[model samples]
Each structure stands twice: as structure tokens, then as C-alpha cells.
Target: MFFATTALALLIERFIGYPDILVRTIGHPVQWIGAFIAWLDARLNPESEPGNRLAGMLALLALLVVTGGLALAVALALRKLPYGWVAEAIIATPFLAQKSLAGHVRAVADGLDRSLAEGRSAVSRIVGRDPEQLDRSGVARAALESLGENASDGIVAPAFWLALLGLPGIALYKAINTADSMIGHRSPRYLAFGWAAARLDDLVNLPCARLTGLLFALAAYFSSRTSAKAAFAAMRRDAHRHVSPNAGWPESALAGALGVKLGGPRAYGGRHVDLATMGDGKSELDANDIRDGLSLYGDALSLLAVIAVLLALAF
Candidate 1:
């Protein structure tokens, strides 16, 4: 199932690519599916209790199955509809955004080089951190950090799950990720309720995150700015140091791959958050550095697509 889905997805990605209208159309159905799932969740468990945890878990599992089936059904349904393979390909293409990912990262650097305010506004769309006080270097780092983390969340993780489990797998992963983003927080009210969602999201991301590092390293080897060997070594040494077991893998690899330091101190919600810096070289980052990071990141994704193609062929 994984092989077939990945093969078809990769082919669609290579040929038709992502179209804005296609992405927008996908959102309509995904929203309806998500709303139906949420309604069911609320009706099944209205209040929090020890037993509710078990019930919620069961409900989520059932939801995963149902949503997965629906995604597959929708894909098949699309195939039989008008406009032939071109339209179906467009529908599948938005699900993977390899080219757009690199373009957006480049825009951040462009905005920062022009003006800090411009940089902040452009980056704020991509990151949750406050952008107002960010200096030139801070803007670059934030953009790079977002690239690292989102490479997993927005691209690789979805591909990984979908490849393994088909539309159902991707839908299940997205649903869980959405739940975590919505309520899987550490706030007082959600401490207990969001625990499962958070843990499950982490588990889903673990392997894909590590694979992200490996891809970055491969990209570094092909690029002129950095050394892939050093990137791999640094990833092995520094990946576990971050608070998130999964995030550190890609961030550390990207830091070593680009020869720039990332993941330092920052402010959030009026609170100081100290973070472990990845890589030991190049404390200062500029627009050129951001470009280098994006290029290497692009290479990493290219490597991922190639591997996905190869895997699909092999299996």
C-alpha cells in the first residue's frame, strides 16, 4: 500500500506539481471531513473523566480508520470524475509542495534584506515567534528554524505516513496533528486532555524527523557551502539535546549543513525561553546565509523525492 501510494504521489508531484486552486479545493473537502470528525468526537465524549480518556482513545482510533477510508474513497472518486488524469493529478499534487517550500523560505531572506519590518511580516506568516524586535540575523534564524521544523511537519511527515498507509494513513496523521495543534498543549486545562494527542504526534514524527537530517546531509554533500560528513556527525551528537526529541534532528543537521548556529535564546509570550543552539560554528547569519540554508534545504528535499521514487520502484 505504501509503495503504490508513494509511487503515484511522486509521479503526480513530478508531472503536474502544486497549483493554488487545487490546494484550495483540497481544503474544502478536508475541512468537511475534519468537521465531521470533530462533531463525532464531541458527541462521543462531552466531559473529561478517567474513563473518558479510554473512550477518547477509542474514539480517535475509530476516527482514524473512518477518515482514512474516506480519503481513499475521495481519491478514487476524483479519479472517476471529469477532466481525466490531469485534474486528478492536480488534486494529488497539492498534497506535496516540494517547490513551493523552497520559494517561501527564499522570500523570507529577500524580505529581511530589504527591511526588518518586511522580514518580520513575511516571517510572521510562517513562525509563531514574535517578529517585531527581531534583528536581521534574528529574522534569518527564525526563518531557517521554521524551515527545519516545518520540513517535517508540513512535508516529510505527511509523505511518510501517506506512503505507508495510503490516503487513510495521511488523513489519520493530519487529524492527529491538527488535534495536537488545537488542544495538545501544556496549559492547565489541557494538561491531561492533550497528552495523548501530543505523544501520538511525536511518535508519528520520530522517524521522519531523523530522515530529514539524513536528507539535509545528502544535500550538503552535493552543495558547495558545507560538508555532509560533518552534518551527519553533528546531527548524531546534537539531535538529542533539543527539548523536542524529533525537532532537533533536522535543525541540527541543517545548522551543520549550512555552517550556521541555530536554536538559541528567544522570547515568547513575554517569557524568556532558553534553547540549545545547534552546531558550534558561525554565530552570525545574514541574507546570504539564509540563501545557503534554503539551497541546502532544497537539496535535502530533492534527495527525499529521489529516495521516495527509488523505494516505490524497489518495492
Candidate 2:
């Protein structure tokens, strides 16, 4: 079920690109789902009367039960909809994009190689770093950073959730993640409201993120062009060093696999976010780094394919 769910997710994403119609409908409704859940949570407690740890735990349970139930219902409906699972599967295949990850990364590099201004603009969409003052190296670094972080957020995490819980699970995961991205900040407005969304997203991605790193190491090992042993070692050594408990795993694994360093100080919203580096090595990055990221994405997908095959055999 887990493996099929993963493949189905890949297939759906590849084909549909989350149709604008679906996005316009589901996306907004999903936001309201969060809003509804938040409202429920608030109703459970009065501001003048704070809840205790036990009350908090109960609230969490209630939230999960409600959210998970709704998600499960949606998954069942998607399965039964006129949209055949076969069609969904076909659409999902292209969405997986092991081949395209590198292409996207390369475009940024190629764009940068042509002009730093062009590179910065292209890379800015994917990365949170300031692009206005970027040079060649900065553009490359920002692109690499986006590649690493997004490999998890945009790929592995979605794959993992979908695999485990089907369409509803994936939908819910995306909702939580999107909410976190939008509102789960330490700002004055969302600190308390976004707490549940942020924490839940982190919890959901915890295992998938680590698994992605391991898959990355295995892929490098199998590639023969790279040292799998080194990749694995580097991942083990540096996976936990990044500020994001989950992102460091795959990013560090890729960095070690490709023999390049990623992560460092960057400007976000005009403020410099001085982050620790992941993987040990010089920070020099180029088209080659993007090449490695592309390779890793392929390897991870191949690994998923193998898992699918093994499951078929076992079943």
C-alpha cells in the first residue's frame, strides 16, 4: 500500500501538475480546513483560561482525529471518482520527474552562466535568498540550496505522505505544509495560531526526510561514478547539523555524494540568515553540483521502482 501510494502520487503529479481548477478549488478549501480546525481548537479553550499539558494533548488528538478522518474520506472519494486510478497513475508518472530535477537546476546555472542578473531572477523563484546582489557563485549556491530543500519539500515529503495515506494523506500533507510555509512563522501574528501546523508538518516529514538521504547514499553507491561509501559516511556525519532537523539528511547526503558543500549565510527578506553549512568541504559549486542533484533524484526514483518491483514479487 505504501509503495503503490508513492507511485500513484508520482504518476498523478507528473501528469496533472495539480490542475489549476483543482488548485483553485482544493487549495482554498484546504486553507479553510485549516481555518476550521483552528476554530475548533480555539473553541475547546478560552483565552482567559489556559489549558494544561493534558488538555493540549487532548486537543492534538481531537485535531488529528478530525483531520485524518476528513482526509481518509477524501482519499476514498478520489479513488472512486470517474477519474480512473489508471489515468491518475499515468498522470502521476511524469510528475515524479527524476529526469527533470537536473534540467530545472541546470536552467538556473545556464541562465547564470549567461548573465548573473538572469540567473538571480531565475533562481529567486525557488530560493528565499536575496538575488539582487548575487554573483555567479551566489547564484549557483542559491540554486543548489533550493535543489536540496525542495528535493524534500517538493518531492520526497509528498511522495512519502501519499504512499502511506493515499490521495487524502497527500492532500492533507500538502495542506499542512503549505500552511506552514504561509503562516507557521515566529512572527507576532502567527506564533500561536501556526504552532500546530508547523509542528505537525515537521512530525509528518521526519521519517521521509531521513529515508530520502539514505536513498541518496544508496543511489550514489550504485552509480559507480561516485563513492557510495563516502556519501553514506558524510550523510551520517553531517545530516543532523542543519537547522532543519529533516532537510539536513538529504541535503547533506547529496553534498557528500557530490563532493560539494551546501548551506551557508543568506539574506532573506532583507535580513541575513546566518545558517550553518551542511556536509564538509569547500563551498565551490557549479553546473556539476546541479548534475549531482539530478543524479540523486534519479537514483531515489529508481530506488522507489525497485521497491515497487519487490512489493509485486512479494505480493
For candidate 2, lDDT tens digit of each residue in 96-168?
A: 4443555567788778767878788788777766788676777777777677666777677767666665655
Q: Pick the candidate with the highest TM-score.
A: 1
Considering only N, C-alpha and C atoms within 3 Å, which residue pairs clash in candidate 2?
10-92, 11-91, 11-92, 11-93, 12-92, 13-95, 14-94, 14-95, 15-91
List, in order, the clash count of every candidate structure: 1, 9
Residue range 9-121, candidate 1, lDDT tens digits: 65666455666685576554446556765675566545553224565566567667777777778767765766333443344444555566667778898998898888888
Cα TM-score per model:
0.84, 0.77
Worst 10 residues of 2 by lDDT: 90-99
Task: Estimate the lDDT of model 1.
Answer: 0.74
